[model samples]
Target: MKKQTINQKIEIHASAEKVWQVMWNNDSYKKWAAAFMPGSHYVGDLKPGGRIQFLDPSNNGMESDVESVTKNQEVTFRHLFELEAGNAGKTLGDMREKFELVEKDDVTTLFVSSDMPEEYFEEMNTATTSALQIIKEMSEQ
Candidate 1:
């Protein structure tokens, strides 16, 4: 199936470096994504080609290999496993998510955009906002 994209933007009340620190910390993802699946972890390095997963954490996490990552700038990854048993039969494609952080007048704005499937639209949108909020809060903290 052809991939679809979803987009959201967030403004963080923190500096770009502070946001980068928390984002690449590698041990704090659980505090955010857990709200989506009850268990989520920092599964890989924060650099380009690093891997990560957002899963139940009860069963093993569904894996997604990072396609490209740029510190405090952008990150994109692909879903390795089929999202559902149904995706196994089709020409499944990659989902690309980018986080573009821009600073102006001492304010930071995070622009998030994703290429994903329709079914994932709602969840990703909600999660994206929540994740940004958490990151903003954590960065300011």
Candidate 2:
């Protein structure tokens, strides 16, 4: 099992607080993470040691453990799921998705970083990319 790290960034016009609000708020999970939440936005907690669960009607949901969290700064977590029924697939290990906020005069940079297994690293990449795109559009909206 090889470990891999992934990094992605997106500069938004809104503040970090604004982005975080839309990103973690369980109520708006469907608005942002709609790719995962196909039917509706389920309940979840965005706290350290908290559980971030996403439920979909089509059996495409995941539950993870909130390993650590830094308010308005970053959130680290681990994802556990069975690749195949009765068989523990590959644990993504620990995924530390850090959202670093920095203001450059007018534009605010939202840098995202994650560390996970190679197979699941692509999942983070795709999800992060989609999330950032939705965020940018939502910010404009």
Candidate 3:
């Protein structure tokens, strides 16, 4: 399946470390991730070569490999397949997601880039915008 990359960004009035914490901290992750799906969360490790599951309340979502991680700077995931009933399903069209943070003068710019099937471009783009807003709010507060 052909995929298109969706890019979204937000500038937060906070340090990169603060933004990173808000984005990855378990509790905060759920709060912002709700933009995509209520009760959305992740399981497993977040280091390079680790496997992580991005799951919804019903145990359905994506299983991805942690492609790279640079504390306070960047993280990337290569989504391998979908999950249904906590089981791996079909391949997800070589989709990948990356988050990069750059700080200047105490403000952080968070950039999110993700690839998905063309059919989902709009939905994912909107979700990502909302999610980034949530992250910015949480980090600033």
Pairs of residues at least 3 apart in sequence or in different chains that clash in candidate 2: none
Which lDDT tens digits does candidate 3 get at residues 1-141?
A: 888999888999999999999988999999999999999999999999999999999999999999999999999999999999899898996789999999999999999999998888999899998999899999999
Clashes of 1: 1
Q: Residue 46 of candidate 3: its Cα lDDT?
A: 91
Candidate 2 lowest-lDDT run of ten: 81-90
lDDT of 2 by residue, 19-46 (tens): 6777776655577777534563544577
lDDT of each: 0.67, 0.65, 0.94
By lDDT, the better pick of 2 and 3 is: 3
Winner of 1 and 3 under TM-score: 3
Alpha-carbon runs more than 4 Å astray in model 2: 35-42, 82-90, 104-106, 120-124
Please give the distance, in angstroms, between residue 81's alpha carbon in candidate 3 and its true position after superposition.
0.1
Q: In what order do the candidates fall by lDDT, top score first?
A: 3, 1, 2
Regions of model 3 farther than 4 Å from truth: none
Worst 10 residues of 3 by lDDT: 87-96
- Where does candidate 1 have its weakest 10-residue lDDT segment? 83-92
lDDT of 1 by residue, 1-141 (tens): 556687777787888767777766656666766555666654555556676654555544455677777666667767665433222323336656677788777678888787777887788778878887888788778
